[model samples]
Target: MSGAGSVGNDVDIDIGALFASLRRNWRFILVGALALAALVLLFCLLSTPEYRAETRVLIETRESIFTRPNGETAADRPVLDQEGVKSQVEVLTSADLLKKVGAKLDLAATDEFGKPSLLSRGLIALGLKRDPSQIAGDENMLREMREHLQVYNVPDSRVIVVQFSSEDPALAAKASNAIADEYITLQRAAKLQSNDDATDWLEPEIADLSKRVKESEAKVANYRASSDLLVGQNDSTLATQQLSEISSELSRVRANRAASEAKAASIRRALETGAPLDTLPDVVSSGLMQRLRERQIQLNTDIADLSTSLLDGHPRIKALRSQLADLNQQVRGEGRKILKSFENEASVARLRETELTRELNGMKAQAARAGGKAVELRALEREAAAQRELLQTYLTRYREAASRTDHNYLPVDARVFSRADTPAEPYFPKTLPIVGATFVAGLLLLSIFVLLRELFSGRAMRPIDGVAQAPANEIQMPAADETAQPVPGRAIAEERAAAGTEYPARPPASAETIQQIYDSYTTIGDDVPENPHSVHAIASRLIETGISRGLVVSPEGDDGSAASVHLARELADRKLRSILIDMTGTGAISRTMLDGKTVAGITDLLASEKQFTDVIHSDHYSDAHVMPLGLADPERAMRAIDRLPIIFDALEAAYDFVIVECGPSNAESVKRLTSATTQIILSVVDPDDNAVALSALDLDENGFEDVIILTGAESSTPTPPSGDENPNPRPAL
Candidate 1:
């Protein structure tokens, strides 16, 4: 039952435990809070604030009316084109427009500190800003301006917003409005300048190009007149005639040269003896050579026929031989004639060749001259062509410019849709929001710090409850005093009567039996039963129970000296014989229990100054006696209890129950007296006092038979009905 109660009690929680845990780790929580606050303050101090201003612009596009061929106006034209509105919105934020805005605003100027006024100081510190000259060269002023400005089309709408921010509120608002106005003005000025410049530049260019075109045409006419070269009729006839004449002359010269070369070669060959005449084979087999050979063969055949008919000695044969000889001679003569003809032809060829050479040279010289003239004319023609092309280009440009100027028509969707207006309030580091943001940021940092500290610390613990209501397994009754009730007369009388009839009453049992008897009487049970060892009780039919004895033991040396009054009252209610002995040389316990009654105590008894019995007081409990430590010198109380053995022996013999209330365990006197006690029960209230008690127990080294821990008594009503009446109800110590 006790074990189950303990298990149930173990699950209970104590609120005090949580308080105790916090108390133990107060430093952690406090330090965390302070550090968090400090970090919050630091962040709040370091951060900067930003604000923005925005202006909205509406884009509108109008459709133009187109006249039909018959001069009828087109109907059902769309008012605003979505694509045109989108394109305008895009153009408004374009770099070209923004550049003009920057120029109009004179954004390149610096402040008194020589720092660029339009650029952020933070950007400059971070080395993001370039030199002003470099910025100008790259036309980067617009880029820098755009960094501070933002343009966005409102979703599902044709409205656009131009937002800008600056450290200075007024400057931000001014710049925003200025950008819008300058963009519109720049568009107008750019269009006008472009058109005017186009017209101004094209007029002289077109006139000069026209003059160049006329000059080119005159050059072309002059080239035609100077050349006078006919295409086919005249030149072709003349060239054909010349070619025929040259061809005839060349053929004649070639034949003559061939014959002359052949004659000269033969003569040279004859002069130079043994020289081989290596004539061409084709020449030998030519038709002309074949005809000549055929004629010679026919003549020879006639001569041979004539020779066959005539005798060798006949005049006719002689004449034929002579004729044959003559023919050979004639052939030789003809050969010579041919050679002479070749020589004459050679002479003619030489002369003809010389004349033809002169003529050909003349023709070549004329051709060279013509070619040079053609080259010059071609150069002039190229120049004229280039001039004509340039003229055409310039004339076209000039015409376009004149046309545009005359028409004076703006491009579609070019007109202004919205104008900049002055803002009512400046935009910049907003005061309320900045301060509020700082506070919020600080709090956030503080919370983080606290959370981190909680995560890292390790001092939290669980709680306990219901200790006061938990059942007790051991009983602790105070020492008896004068107020204690005596056992009932009938109960005592019955016990005596049964004892007389049976086994005679003998000397009392040992302290162990006394302890047992105390346990039984205090335990709740049925009425007293008869002693089986007493025969007379059965014969007389009288139920008699043996009288129970109990000991009201105090702490080893504490007795009940300091707590004697309370102990006496508690003992009286329990109907126990309780005696309080102040073994120390102090009469405090005796005086307190007896209500200031003067009592001779241990001091007087030990010195033989007063009898031991004379110091006892019995008013506080029915069967209880109080003996003070006596009014001895403080030095005697400090003396060792081993020196006072007689006093302990006398008290043990005189009382059925002895309650020795000694001094604190630290006193040399108490340690010595602890050895004389059979059991020890320690009274304690303060937790630290328990430590002292444990220390004293350790010092003894010899373990006591019993050690009971007691809480200091407090004056209160009897235990409430629902509370445990006997927390440790086994027996009193």
Candidate 2:
């Protein structure tokens, strides 16, 4: 018979027992592993060997500099990206290309691709699989080829790998290489067909473009002629050129008229003022005026000489004077003639300017009319130029297409770089790995089965020491004492059950475990207070130092617990929110503060029997809150006692001071509740007691340098007021 032991409803598993079980069954495990390895090896030896062969093809633009289009360079060759390479991989395995390869290799004549297997035929007959025979002959061959053929692009490269598997090594290599060769052939065939189509399409397009070119040019010529938009110098219209020339001539003629008029006016001024004719530039430039002036000078010289030598009325002197007078008259007459000639020149210049201005105006009007017509002419020219450009482009393309068609020089975008070679070894049924993996797997599986059998038979289980065994379905509540409180959820369930409503039961908590944990804490039974004045001092220190949380160690049991209550009440009196947690085994703090009311507390929370809200109760006689010792198994609650610091943290956040009264504890016993910020207080009726000194020394050794020894009155209740008329006497403090 098998027997199992459980502690708190958990089965205890023994590692030593499991190892012993494996030791006793080693022969069986070894035999099973060897049998599995032998079977795998035999299967490997009997399986048909499949030879795999591979061929590699590089996909890229194959055009050389000389064979490329007119304007294309070597750098302009299209390189395939990964997607393009993958597209070429699909092309390599295309149905049409594979069919060609299959026919070329005569794969349909071989047993591999010739007929369906007997099993496959049977399955097809039963409608369990599709029938290959129902497909066409070419499709059947293609389908068979697809199963054996593998095409994929190499990672991050334009190289595609084509592989084929067959029983015959030579056939594998032949089929792989044949597929690559046929793929290239198909690429070239496609290019050739495309070129032929382009040639056929371009013939009509070129002819139409040629006709358009001729018609557009004729329209340009006709428009130019009809609009009379004849181009002259610098490609400008004839009317514009004539207008420019006439305007220049008019400006020159007007300038000449102004110059002549100024000159004629100056000569007339000289004549009327009787100024010297030689001083006038126009008069001095005249030949007749200059001669007359010369003659007058000569005659004046002769008269002066004759008057000095002969009488005033001598014949020689008389002749000289008469000639001088005649010369003077001739000078005056010559000046008038020169002035009149200048006037006539001015009139001629004015007449020429008027004629030229009239011609310029006529030319401008003709040019303006031609400008409007020239806009239409320019539109025709642009259309003709565009058509001519399009025609030239078509002619170039048609010539290139025709040349290619005649030469049959279409090049494929890909080429076979490495031909497939026959594999020397079979590609599948690796003997060593198969046998080794089977052996390891079988050994592991058999070992697990043995362990499970041992565990299920209860031979691998042992009783866990110091763990209380209890029934899973039964819940044992802590025995009722002066401060033992009922679980909140259980109390609610009891009430609801009494009212004819059922509530779901909570999980069971072991009561024996909780009581053992509580009873295990050592307590001092002396309850007499030693120093009453020290309680006020401790409270004042706690308030002044702003201590939010502390661990209270009581060496004198209820007396020390009563001091903690007094300290909490004193802090409350000082307007600080204070809460006291009773962690003593005797429940002294809860008994004094709770006023005989039963409420769930920290132990219930730790045991998962009640929530925090259901565990905290208010003090009856003071403003402080109190947490009682709960009715949960202390052993199970101690399992979760590590959560005490978290509870202190939550109380510290809500209250100004959180004080936990530990009845009798050393440093190690309360280590979880202590931190750097937590103050340690030793509460004793006698400050000099051996136990009190030992507790303080223990806390000091555990890194708590500040231990406050508080001694106060034994009675937790405060004194009543003296006045009978006072309506509200002070409550317990």
Candidate 3:
């Protein structure tokens, strides 16, 4: 059995076992450590010693210190320094370079790493070392030579390291230095070959490109001279700009000429219709018309004066009227002169517009010829531009290539900055470090083995230690002031009895004292939890993990029912369909606390008197429900639910949470419920007596998985049920 001993709501860890595990297995640990040390020492002693020698090569990215460094980038430094260094390292360890070194040193003729001891040969034959090539010659030795050489770059630096190892110290140093020297020579040879190749290919290509560039430029000049398409400041020809200006001016002149003609025509219409000549602005503003209008006004005044003072047949009055008529004729004559002037001006504007239109048409023809020539000139110019760019590129590359050839530039990226010295001691077979590491490894393994063994050991396999054990002197009896209330299902049995139906004759259950339980509800202003937060936390975990249903139990079974009811109520507050089921076979406490009677419960449902629908009752708080244990013949009811898995499954499926207040100290009920559930909470009468309480639980015998403790809050205590009377029962309806 796996026991989780809890304090409050947290399970206590047995830290003592971790320390005890090491104590009990100290001898085994000592023996293992000693054995590992011995093996390391033996291996170190037998291992062959070899000397290592290294040489450092400075990888010059742009220029060497001997040559004054400049801000200008090297002509050949296209790649980054890191990449260049990596390439040099690969070149130094290349197979071709190793083959040259092997031939020069006559490595195949010499006897080094050629014959191995039986143990080494066995390890090699087992393919620990790669199988050597079958071909027997300098090629095979060249491959072996590569294995002895190591090349790498120093961190954050352009310097490369060339290392070699051998039984002979002098040979190791000599080989390392020789490889570095050979790499430099190879770099020089490669650069010289590249410069030679570039010069040979580019010499003829550049000559041809230069000739083509001259030809393209000549053609561009000749085409420009032939085509009269002169380039303006904005790439447009002057003719194009001139033509656009003329076209806009001609449009404006034509518009002015049309307006003048229209005005003159309007004046002519007025003269023909004998409309008032004063209506025309030309006529009204004329000096002659204004003078005539003044004279007419004077004549009319004279004629009126003469008529008021003399007889109607006066010759002087008639003469003055004749003078007024003559003045009016003069005003009409002036109006005619102004109209004639407007007609002549309009006729001149029409002739000027005709001349401009003729000139504009000719200019358009000239622009059309120039435009065609410009298209051909542009195509020729594009080809010339392309040729010029290519020629410039060729000249630059050719000059650079030629300069390198003349200077005999050594294009090596790295030069040897330091040479390797013969090593005094072997770099391998570190005895002390090997021994220490092996000992530590053995100790680690031994600790794990001992701990696992102790974990499954009989003494550590104790049942849960959180069982609530009341003090020996003070038994957890029911509350003194409260006795049992009416049994909920007692009335259902009575109704059956009155109706002449056969009934279970068992004594009615004593109802429970329930104020303490009801007060546990936080809604009523009392929180009866040692840690309300922890209760909610645990409830959330249970709900999250799909436990949903479990029994709350105690060793003495005194306050377990009260605790169970409180937990169910808290779960209901979280909006879960949490309900309490008094599987105590006595709904006495339930009826008293709920202040309600069970109409028909599990017994009636099982007996076919009522269905499950008729038995479920809503509690006072939220939507939480309660299902009481109704009265039935004890023997038949127990037998009917002997396979209680079905009944518990149905109840769990029906509610989000089904809290079983299993009658106290019932291990069988706990086992049955836990098997069908994922969580089990154990309530305690006295939290201080944890160890004694845990021992009383006998969890190993019960076989429960998880058990949480609801402790230190004895404020909500349960009372004993005193009544044997049957409570009221309603019909199935």
Candidate 4:
């Protein structure tokens, strides 16, 4: 039994024995490597050396502020983007530009470009090949120049690199600098041609615009004369100004008429009511009334003096009383005349007011007519102004274009920033790298062969009897049927567990196995075991592609969401930095990852109610992070949905793999969260689910060609019950 056990253990490989055999064969590996290196060194020595020189051109518009056209700024200068720089590269390598450079360098007469092969010359002499005279000299030289020229654009910049190679170092430098100079000259010539074209185009346009402006101005003047709409001061019509003046005069006349009438009525009331006339302002202001009142007062005083000196029937007293009565009669007559004069003044004022009012009405009618004609006049003026503006713009452009063409102010869009210099060393046949690489490769190959031979010959085999004879650690597992075979990965995990060690993380499987997993997703029956369709397989593929972000979709509702939870956990188990974002509003991920706790999540972040640090929560059962859909209003959250890409970018930068669980989401709904490299994983519980097929087809049509379908046992994270124990419990009626 002991001999059989030792023989059984002989099949095991011993890493120590393999290394020992390799050490014994060190001389063979060294000899082989030295021979390979020697051959490479000889080849380098025999190869002809070619020298290369380069010139760099910066493609940009070099127009200065003073030289640029009016109303043009630096912002208006054309920017040379990547494609623009590439276009400049094509221009540099063009046959026309290269021919100019070749002619300048006299390349066609040089031996390198002008001379044909000896075999070709021999054949031509024998009439077996086409005669050399049949081919054009320029075409032959152009072909040779193109073969020697190398032009390319620098990545993410507006610089182009021009390189030339030749056996003569001085010729290489001269050719490269010549190419740059000729290309710049070509650009300047093209600009000059464009300016000439612009000047020719603008000349006719400017003339036409000037003619239109003159015609429009003449039409405006003729219309103004016919309609009698002459412009007055302050840009108003003459009729309007006259009407305004008449209206002002009419107002003054009516105000004076009213004042005169009021004064006449006041005097009349005083006469009727027996009030004092002297108290009246109009009566007191009159000189005639004042003199009359003084005379009457003197007569009264004389009568009083005579009554004291003479008898009651005296003739002097009677005469004085008669004089006083006459004085009162005269005062009454003067008061009547003053009242009549006031009436006359009121009458004249009223007549004048009526005449002015009629004149104002007539002027209003004339002004209305002028306003109607002024509309047409204004239309003509606007047309004239528009034409004048257009003429001025054309004249400005024509002058600028003509000035540029006349003064030869054309500037090329590119300049040589770095000119080529003669190189002292050859560019090809790097000696050290070639020899060292050959020696390392030869040694590594010989060592691998020796190690393989030792293992195949059983010299590297070691007996495992000692380990196999040791007591096996017991593993506790659920009881199953006897016919049930263990899964390969799970059995390995169980064996590791039994030996009191953690299950090791596995690297990505082969491409064939990954393709098989994808095929099994479409073809595997519902009765198939879940281990083959486990989320671990998807995790391995994710690791293999180095995908940092994934959009998880669940077509079969919460069941698929559970699978995404498992995927996140499986990725975390593999020691990858993974996070699960729960976009599903059903709180399925929250129940599993957060144990039914309501926390701030992506919706909260979008709503600006929480930040990234506040929303990302640690998974309760695993190392994976969880971002659950929070209590923020869904409508409000969707208002800021445009910010989802920024959130995804931040998460991708922070973690290795970000898995977003979108329950029952379509391509359009999740389009904002995906990128060109984002992996799409469809988590479905049933293999035969019709929703899975439909969703897959929809995703494929939407440009997601590599949709990964995760169909396996439901997530071990427990789903919430149907009753009211849910965190987001439904409200009762």
Best by lDDT: 4
lDDT of each: 0.53, 0.80, 0.70, 0.81
The residue-by-residue lDDT of candidate 2 on 589-669, one tens digit each, is 676677555578888989999988888887776788888888888899999988998888888888999989898888888
Write candidate 3's Cα lDDT for 292-344 as tens digits.
77788788888888889877578898788778878877877776777677778
* Order of models, best lDDT first: 4, 2, 3, 1
Residue 190 of model 4, lDDT score: 91
Off by more than 4 A, model 3: 1-47, 56-60, 63-77, 80-89, 104-110, 113-137, 152-161, 218-238, 241-357, 414-419, 438-733
Task: Give the lDDT of residue 708 in candidate 1.
Answer: 42
Residues 444-477, candidate 1: write the lDDT tens digits: 5555554444434522222234234534755555
TM-scores for every candidate against the unseen true structure = 0.29, 0.51, 0.46, 0.52
Q: How many residue pairs clash in each candidate?
A: 17, 4, 8, 0
lDDT of 4 by residue, 129-150 (tens): 8765678998888977888889
Task: State how far residue 343 of model 2 sits from its true place (Å).
Answer: 10
Tell me, what's the RMSD of every candidate? 40.8, 19.9, 19.1, 18.8
Candidate 2, TM-score vs. the true structure?
A: 0.51
Answer with 3 or 4, whichever has the higher lDDT. Answer: 4
The local lDDT score (0 to 100) that residue 614 gets in candidate 3 is 78
